[model samples]
Target: MGNIVSCCSLDENKKYLNDDEILETFSNSEINEFKKRLKNNIQIVVLLQDGTKLPCNLQANFQEKTLCISCHQKVKNKND
Candidate 1:
């Protein structure tokens, strides 16, 4: 497992894009649709440098445009 980093911190992650810094051709309606879908939940596949595809479930804060990574753990049954 890798170390967990805070996405909210600008100092921690310099890759964060400011509102003006981001260049998007999407219309307001399209952007709103994306935000709406994100609120429900979205599955994103990240392709690593080594060619590994990692699937992640995420939710977003519309105001901040920030993401919250979701993780689910499976519990083992003692009777099994």
Candidate 2:
């Protein structure tokens, strides 16, 4: 049998990410580029470690100080 792969670390206590935590994952230039793409309505895909490309629309949750992705369900279904 093949070993199962997990996309994210299992952390039962974790719920949501804060601003700093989210920003830390990307460089300043990358963040700027993402914002520009978001404004232009350009399509973007997140490349996963498992070699899956998940189509996403980036959005900010200011109240929560977090970033979110509105994924394309069709793409996800096809990939799965």
Candidate 3:
């Protein structure tokens, strides 16, 4: 699995993002690049502003070059 190259904080009340709101965090070019480099299943991670890292299964549409974080569990922060 590839590790995260960068991090961005998305401060929102919604813990889970719906399919339609997948592009909220990334741009078209970013998504395209991601899809192009995706050889197989990869680990999807969501990092909160409070330093909580949540692992989740993200749905990717290669043809559409889109990704969706439908759901994720709130895991305790390692620092805690």
Candidate 4:
């Protein structure tokens, strides 16, 4: 793993999206494109910490200003 982009916090048991950081990681336009794809209900893949690319559905919550990604299989860290 390069750097921990984002992770499911153990305490909250919630996935954290470093929106600002993620935007910086990729082009801002790319982020917007992802949003568009999500709006279209297109399935997308998210790269996990352990270098696993998982297929998931992107859910955007405007109110919360967050992206919720759901994958069918369980995701685990490489160390695990």
Candidate 5:
């Protein structure tokens, strides 16, 4: 399917935000939440090799290969 995600807002990054920024009713570990998402999002640029896909502007690549112009181009196109 298309990135229908764009049509439906996904708040993939409400973690970094402090408690004051989000809805009330706290009860769990925000860091843990971030850790879960970190599993699959390791970008090639801006160097976040910790494997944590934090709210960044770069793109993700897990091919065990280095980032190249082609990868950058793909990320650009995806945003377009």
Candidate 6:
């Protein structure tokens, strides 16, 4: 909606970011952040190493060694 920014490549992905740094950590924080972002219509996206883009929740299990999600269906990458 905001000019349709693209996350088209794995190289464009961001470095590992822990939840404490910028994301909403607790339940209340998560709700508040979601509400605030929705209210302001802010865009939040995630680009995985394989160039797959998805809207990630505030807290996700990304503790795996490589931070990879082998998504079979993605609009950005279409791995399958």
> In model 4, where do residues sit more than 4 Å from their true spots?
1-40, 75-80
C-alpha TM-scores of all predictions: 0.45, 0.35, 0.35, 0.38, 0.21, 0.21
For candidate 2, the per-residue lDDT at 8 reads: 68
- TM-score, prediction 2: 0.35
Which structure is stronger by lDDT: 2 or 6? 2
Where does candidate 3 have its weakest 10-residue lDDT segment?
71-80
Question: Against the unseen true structure, what C-alpha lDDT does each candidate score?
Answer: 0.73, 0.72, 0.69, 0.76, 0.44, 0.54
Model 1: ten consecutive residues of lowest lDDT: 71-80
Off by over 4 Å in 5: 1-28, 42-80
Local distance difference test, candidate 5 = 0.44
Which residue pairs show collisions in model 3? Answer: none
A best-first ranking of the candidates according to their TM-score comes to 1, 4, 2, 3, 6, 5
lDDT per residue for candidate 4 within 9-71, as digits (tens), equals 475776677877656778779978977876656688888776788888877776688877778
- Reference-based lDDT, residue 9, model 3: 71
Kindly list the per-residue Cα lDDT of model 1 for residues 40-60, writing each as its tens digit. Answer: 889876665666666777899
Angstrom error at residue 41, model 3: 3.9
Please report the TM-score between candidate 5 and the true structure: 0.21
- Poorly placed runs, candidate 2 (over 4 Å): 1-42, 74-80
- Tens digits of lDDT, candidate 2, 1-80: 77769756877896788998888989989988877665555556988766888887777654677666777654434343
Deviating ranges (above 4 Å) for candidate 3 = 1-40, 75-80
Q: Judged by lDDT against the true structure, how good is candidate 4?
A: 0.76
- The C-alpha stretches of model 6 lying farther than 4 A from their native spots are 1-26, 44-80
Pairs in clash, predicted candidate 6: none
Model 3: lDDT equals 0.69
RMSD of each: 11.7, 10.0, 15.2, 13.2, 14.6, 13.7
Model 5, position 59: C-alpha lDDT score: 28
Kindly give the stretch of ten consecutive residues in candidate 6 with the minimal lDDT sum.
60-69
